[model samples]
Target: MIGRLNHVAIVVPDLEEGARVYRSTLGAKVSEAVDLPDHGVTTVFVELPNTKIELLHPHGEGSPIAKFLESNPSGGMHHVCYEVDDIIAARDKLESDGMRVLGDGEPKIGAHGKPVLFLHPKDFMGTLVELEQV
Candidate 1:
């Protein structure tokens, strides 16, 4: 069902500052902030093999990102996204295993047009998991 660790998302107060730190301090090659209006965020992606570090800042106070930042003071590890060959199959597997998905039906489009679904953190021992079809 799951393929690889895709990315660890981080909610940041400043996207630019986060990108600078990841690039200059950690020596990561950072991408220009990618505005995902549909998701209500401006994200900077630090590409890594089979995984990445996504720096996210809220587009506005009403955005979900803002609430996430408010909930987790450290703003680290908002979600652990997994890469899968088949997101639909992954969702089915999770459901059959008695996991509660955060949706009613079909999965939705995610970053970069990838199909994605969220398996409730309550079901995975408090780890918010995102399954993405790449």
Candidate 2:
């Protein structure tokens, strides 16, 4: 089952500008952009009291974010991540309930070095949901 709200991801056209808006304008603590080549994104985290805001930009021509940006040129909320104590159990339960899991339906290492799984947006009211093992 889901635990806490992990992070809300925002796909941005420019990672620098996104970080600037969160850091300089909002006076937030933002981390340096880290390239996640495997995930096809460059990300920066804006620390918050309860959760984090992840700024993501396309890392390569074939990146998924690139495809997302094609439709939403100005960028937008990409996904919401929630923590889970047992991701395998959660996945099994979700599958039994007829929810589709993205990719190979296996947990992958996420930005925080935790096991993560992405659920199909259609299964969750048009919002792509990410489950991260805590």
Candidate 3:
């Protein structure tokens, strides 16, 4: 069961600039930086009243953000993350329904160390879907 919209990830060329915009300009309280080495991403958080936004950039070649930036250096919206109660079950259903999983298989830890899995955009009308176990 998906709980709610957890966060929207936006790839950026500069993490500091992104933070300044989302924090000072938007009045969002920024959180600590989160490094997901496995995914090759360095993420920073912006806490909001209702939800949060994650500013992302590639930390290495393995990052999806790297590929995203290569195609469009200006960066763009990466994906939307939804909170889920049971990621395993959700992944199973999506898999059985023929959703393409981005990673090899199984859920992996995300920015906040929560179990996360991504559904290929081809399965969601070009919108990448991410499920995070809350």
Write one digit per residue (lDDT tens) for candidate 3, span 21-127. 88889888997667777878998988888898889888866776788888879879989999999988998888898888887868888767799998899889999
Q: Compared with the true structure, what per-residue lDDT tens digits does model 1 show for residues 1-134?
A: 57788899889877888999999999988999988888888999998765799998887447767878888766777899988998777877888888888978488898769888888899888999988898
Q: What TM-score number comes out for model 2?
A: 0.96
Q: Rate the local accuracy (lDDT) of all candidates.
A: 0.84, 0.93, 0.87
Candidate number that wins on TM-score, 1 or 3: 1
Stretches of candidate 1 off by over 4 Å are none
Candidate 1 — worst ten consecutive residues by lDDT sum?
A: 58-67
On lDDT, the leading prediction is: 2
The order of the candidates by TM-score, greatest first, is: 2, 1, 3
Best by TM-score: 2
Error of 1 at 130 (Å): 0.3
- What TM-score would every model get versus the actual structure? 0.92, 0.96, 0.90
Residues 10-91 of candidate 2 have per-residue lDDT tens digits of 9998889999999999999999999998888899999999999999999976887788888898999999999999999999
Where does the lowest 10-residue lDDT sum fall in candidate 2?
60-69
